[model samples]
Structure formats: structure tokens, C-alpha cells
Target: MTGGEVAGLIAAIAFLILAVGIAIFVLRVAAVTKEVKQTVSEVNKTLDVVNSEMGGLTHEVEGLLVKANTLLNDVNGKVATIDPVFTAVGELGESVSALNNSTRNLVTRVSGGVVNTTKATVVARAGQKAYAMFKKNKTEQPTK
Candidate 1:
């Protein structure tokens, strides 16, 4: 071949080599960009999951607080109900003590009356016996 034709062929081959190197560099850059995008997507998904779990935990804590308040109210109401019963019991105790005192006074008065009646009966019987004995002795002694 002529010299000019040979030089043209060499120039074409060098141009092809430079194009291939630039294409390889572009492909490497595209691959690194795709990997970075995927990592960012995964981080967003993890944050979303954590946020949803926190919402559920907040609801559970609110429910527990409501239950505790209801239980406290029930205890307070029961105490209020029992307070009247305690007061009534104290009043009943006082009434029973008063009744006992009245019964004791009645029994004491009855006992005193019985003792006085017995003393009067004994004195009257002794006086009648002495009078009968004196009359019998006088009649038996001859006319005096």
C-alpha cells in the first residue's frame, strides 16, 4: 500500500481505542450511582418502620393510664360506701350500752322490793305466834 493509506489506518485504530476507554469509565460511574440509590432507599424504609412502632407504643401507654385512673375512682367510691356502715355500727354500739344500763337499773329496783316484802312477812308471823302462846298459858293456869 501507499504511505498515506497506511497512516490513515493507524489513525482510525487509535480513535477506536480512546472511545472504548471512555465508555468503560462511564459504565463504572453508572454502577456506583445505582448502588448509592439502593442504600438510601433501605435507610428510608428502616426509619418508617421505627416511626410506626413508636406510634403503637404511644397508644398502649395511653390505655394503661386510663385503666389506672378508673381503678383509683372505683377504690374511692367503695371507701365512700363503707364509711356509712362504720358510722352506723358505732351508733348501734352506743344504743346497746344504753339498753344495758336501763336493764341493770330495773333489776336493782325489783331486788330491793323483794327484800322489803320478806322482812315484813317475817315480823308479822313472829308477832302472831307470841300472842297465841300467851293466851294458851293463861287458860291452862286456873282462874287468875
Candidate 2:
């Protein structure tokens, strides 16, 4: 063979080797890009699920707050209702105290009056009996 033909054959073999290396590099880059795209998609899906869970949790918290407010209002209303009852009980206690004082005074007056009248009658009867006894003793001793 001629020297020029031999040089041309060596150059063609080197070009083929370079082309194969470039093709392998491109294929490896494509595979890495595909993996990156899949990872991003999975991240987006996870974010969507997290957002939905957060929304549910927010709704539950709102419901619990409403229930707490309602319970507090009910307790306040019951306390308001009992306020009047407590005042009425206090008034009833005062009335009972007044009635007891009046009853005690009335009973004391009645019993004191009855006792005075009985003492006066007993004193008067005792004086009359003593006078009759003195007259009888004088009559029995006068014959001498």
C-alpha cells in the first residue's frame, strides 16, 4: 500500500473512536436528566399531600375553637341564671331571721303576762286566809 493511504486509514479509525465516546457521554447525560425529572415529580406529589393534610388539620382546629367558645358561652349563661337564685336565697334568709325575731318577742310577751296574773291571784288569796285565821284565834281565847 502507499504511505498516503496508510495515513488516511489511521485517521478514519481515530474519528470512529471519537464518535463512539461522544455517543456514550450523551446517553449517560440523558439518563441522569431523566432521574432528576422523576425526583422532582415525586417531590411535587409529596408537597400536594402535605398541603391537603394541613388543610384538614386547620379545619379541625377551627371546629375545636368554635366548640370551646360555645361551651364558655353556655357556662356564662348558667352563671347568669344562678345569680338571681343566689340573691333570692339571701333574701329568704333575711325574711326567716325577721320572722324568728318577731315570733320570739310575741311568745315572750304572752308568757310574761300570764305569769304576772297568776302571782297576783296567789298573793290576794293568801292575805284573805291569814285574816280569817287571826279572827278565829281571838274568839277561841276570850272566855277568861
Candidate 3:
């Protein structure tokens, strides 16, 4: 064969090798892309499930919040109802303390008056006895 024909044949063989390499690279890229697509699809499904679960969780939390608010309101109402009872009890305690103090003062005054009256009676009786004794002695003796 001539030199030109030999060179052309070498060029054709090189081009065939390049084409084979490009085909192999394209096949590898295609396989990777398919795997990436499957992974993305699975991730999308998982995200959908998580989103649905979050929706239910949000609803449950809202219900819990409402119940908590109701419970707080009930507790507030009960506290409001009991506040007056506690106030009344405190007032009653004060009134009882005042009554006890007044009773103590009255007892002290009555006892003091009784003691004074008894002392006065004893002194009057002693004076009368001494006067009678003096009169008896004067009569028994000569006129003085």
C-alpha cells in the first residue's frame, strides 16, 4: 500500500478507538444519572411522608394547646372563687381575736370591782365592833 493510504488507515483506526471511549463514558454517565434520579425519587417520597406526619402533629399540638388554655381558665376561675373565702376567713379570725380581747378586759374589770367592794365591807365591820366595845367599857366603869 502507498504511504498516504497507510496514514489514512491509521487515522481511521484512531478515530474508531476515540468513538469507543466516548461511548463508554456516555454509558457510565447515563448509569450514574439513573441512580441519582432513583435516589431523588425516594427522597421525595420520604419528604412527603414526613410532611404528612408533621401536619397531623401540628393538629394534635393545637388541640393540646386548646386544652391547656381551658385548664388554665378553669384554674383561674377556681382561684377567683376561693379568694373571697380566704378573705372572709381572715376577717373572721380578726373578729374572734377582738372578741377574746374584750372578754379578757371585762373579766379584769369585774374582778377588780369585787376586790374593792370586799375590802370596803371588811373595814366597816371592824369600825362598828370597836365602837360597841368602847361603849360597853364606858358603861361598866364610873361616869367619865
Candidate 4:
């Protein structure tokens, strides 16, 4: 063959090889793109399921909060009803303490020598007179 013909043949062979290489690269890229598309579809499905579950969980949490509020209100109402009883008990305790203090003070005053000798003598004479009168009346009564 002539030199020009030989050069043309070599150029044609190189072009053919380059075209084949590009075809193989395109095929690999298409396969990778298909796999990526499938992965994205699966991810979307998973996200949808998670969203549905979250909605149900939120609803249950709302119900639980409502129940907790009701229970708290009930407890508060009961405490309110019992508050007067506790207050009355506290007042009763104070009253008892005051009575005890008065008794103690009276006893202390009586035993602490605050009563003078003259007053004591007068009290003793009055007690004797009252006893004598009681005995006289008892003896005067007729027995049936």
C-alpha cells in the first residue's frame, strides 16, 4: 500500500479504539446511575415510614399529657378540701397548749407562796364553818 493509504488506515484504527473506550465508559456510568436511583427510592420509603411512626408517637404523648394534667388537678382539689381540716387541727392544738399554760400558771401561782398567810387563814376558817353546817343539816334529817 502507499504511505498515504497506510496513514489513513492507522488513523481509522485509532478512532475506532477511542469510540469503543467511550462506549464502555458510558455503559458503566448508566449502571451506576440506575443503582443511585434505586437507593434514593428506598431512602424515600424509609423516611415515609419514620414520619408515620412519629405522628403516632406524638398523638400518644398528647394523650399522656392530658391524663397527667387531670390527675394533677384531682390531687390539687383533694388537698384543697383537706386544707381546712389541717388548719382546724392546728388551731385545736394551739387551744390545748393555751389551756395547759393557764393550768401550769395557776398551779405555779398557788404553790409559789403568792397567797398570803392572812388569806390562807381566812380560807381555812371558811372551810371549817362550811363542814360544820353540812354535818348539822345531815343529823337533823329524819330517816324514813
Candidate 5:
């Protein structure tokens, strides 16, 4: 072949090779894009489901909070209603304590005083009887 024809043939073969390479790159890129789109779609669906579940849970938690508040209020109201009764019980306890203290003091003083006084009386009476017996013996012994 001539030099010009040979050069032209080489150029054409190079072009063909370049076209095939470009085609392969494009196909690979397209396949990767398709896979990414499918993954994104699945993520979006999962997100939707999670959102729905969270929304339901939030509503349930709100309901529980409301019930708890209501129960607390009811308990507070009952406590308020019985406040006077508690006060009366406290006053009764105080009165009982006062009475107990008074009784204890009185019993201690009275019992101690009675025991001491009785002992003193018994000693005095014994001395008087002994003196009377001595006088009788002296009068009966002699006139001298």
C-alpha cells in the first residue's frame, strides 16, 4: 500500500478503538446511576415508614402524659380536701402528749411524797410508845 493510504487506515482504526472505550465508560456509568436511584428509593420508603411509626408513638406518649397530669391533679385535690382532717389528727396527738406528760409528773411527785411522809410518821409514833413504857416502869419500881 501507499504511505497515505496506510496512514489513513491507521487513523480509522484508532477512531474505532476510541469509540468502543467511550461506549464502555458510558454503560458503566449508566449502570451505577441506576443502582444509586434504586437505593435512594428504598431509603425514602423506609423513612416514610419510620416517620409514620414515630408519629404514632408520639401521639401515644402525649396521651400518657395527659393521663399522668390528670392523675396528679386528682391526687392533689384529694389531699387538699382532707387537709382539715390531718390537722385535727395532729392536734389530737399534741393534746395526748400534753396529758401524758401531766399524768407522769403528778404520779411521780405524789408517790414519792406519800412514801416519805409515811416513814416519818412511823418513826415518831415508835419513839412516843417507848417513852410511855419507860415512865410506867419507873412509877411501879419504888417510892424511894
Candidate 6:
């Protein structure tokens, strides 16, 4: 071959090698892009499922809150209804305590003023004599 032809042939071969390397790089980039697209699609699908589940969970939580509010209102109403009963019970206890105090005071006053030991002894002796006479009379009478 002539010198020009040989140089031309070498140049052509180098150009061919460079083209082949570029083509291979482009194919690898395409494959990676396809994989990235598939990953994005899967991520979108997962996000959609999660969003749907969250909606249901939100609905259930709202229902639970409503029930809780109703229960709280019911309990508050019951407490209000029975509030008077507790007050009345407290009043009753106070009244009973006052009555007990009054009774104790009355007993103390009566005992301090009325029934000395001498008077009690005399009363007891009189009751015993009266009982003995009544029994004697009953025994003396004939049985009906």
C-alpha cells in the first residue's frame, strides 16, 4: 500500500474503535435509565398504597374520637345527675352528728341535775318492795 493509504486505513480503524466505545457507553446509560424508571414506578405504587391506608386509618380515628367524646359527655352527665345525692348525703351526716352531740349534751345535763346516788338508791329500794308485794298478791290469788 502507499503511505497515504496506510495512514488513512489506520485513521479509519481508530475512528471505528472510538465509535464502538461510545455506542457501548450509550447502551449502558440506557439500561441504567430503564432501571431508574422502573424503580420510580414501584415507589409511586408504594406511595399510593400508603396513602389509601392512611385514609382508612384517618376515618377510623375520627370515629374513635367521636365515640370518646360521647362517652365523656355521658360520664359528665351522670356525675352531674348524682352531684345532689352526694351533697344530701354530706348534709345527712352533718345532721346526724349534730343530733348525736345534742343527745350527749342532754344526757350530760340530765344526769348532772337529776339522779343523785341517794335518790337512785331510794328509787331502787321502792321498786324492789313494790315488786315483792305484787308477786305475793299474785301467788295468793287462785289461778283462773
- Among these predicted structures, which one has the highest TM-score? 5
Q: Which candidate do you rate higher for lDDT, 2 or 5?
A: 5
List residue ranges in candidate 2 displaced over 4 A: 62-144
Error of 1 at 55 (Å): 2.5
TM-score of each: 0.36, 0.41, 0.52, 0.52, 0.55, 0.51
Check candidate 2 and list the clashing pairs. none
Summarize candidate 2's per-residue lDDT along 1-144 as a digit string, tens digits: 899999999999999999999999999999999999999999999999999999999999999999998997787678557655555554554455455556656767978542223443444445445445544554564341
Candidate-wise lDDT, in order = 0.68, 0.70, 0.71, 0.72, 0.70, 0.72
lDDT tens digits, residue span 63-107, model 6: 999999899778767855865555555455555555555665687
- Clash pairs for candidate 3: none
Error of 6 at 18 (Å): 11
Query: RMSD (Cα, Å) of candidate 2?
Result: 31.2
How many clashes show up in model 6?
0
Two-way TM-score contest, 2 vs 6, winner: 6
Regions of candidate 4 where Cα sits further than 4 Å from its true position:
1-39, 113-144
Against the true structure, candidate 2 reaches a TM-score of 0.41
| Residue pairs clashing, model 1 | none
Over all chains combined, what TM-score does candidate 1 have? Answer: 0.36
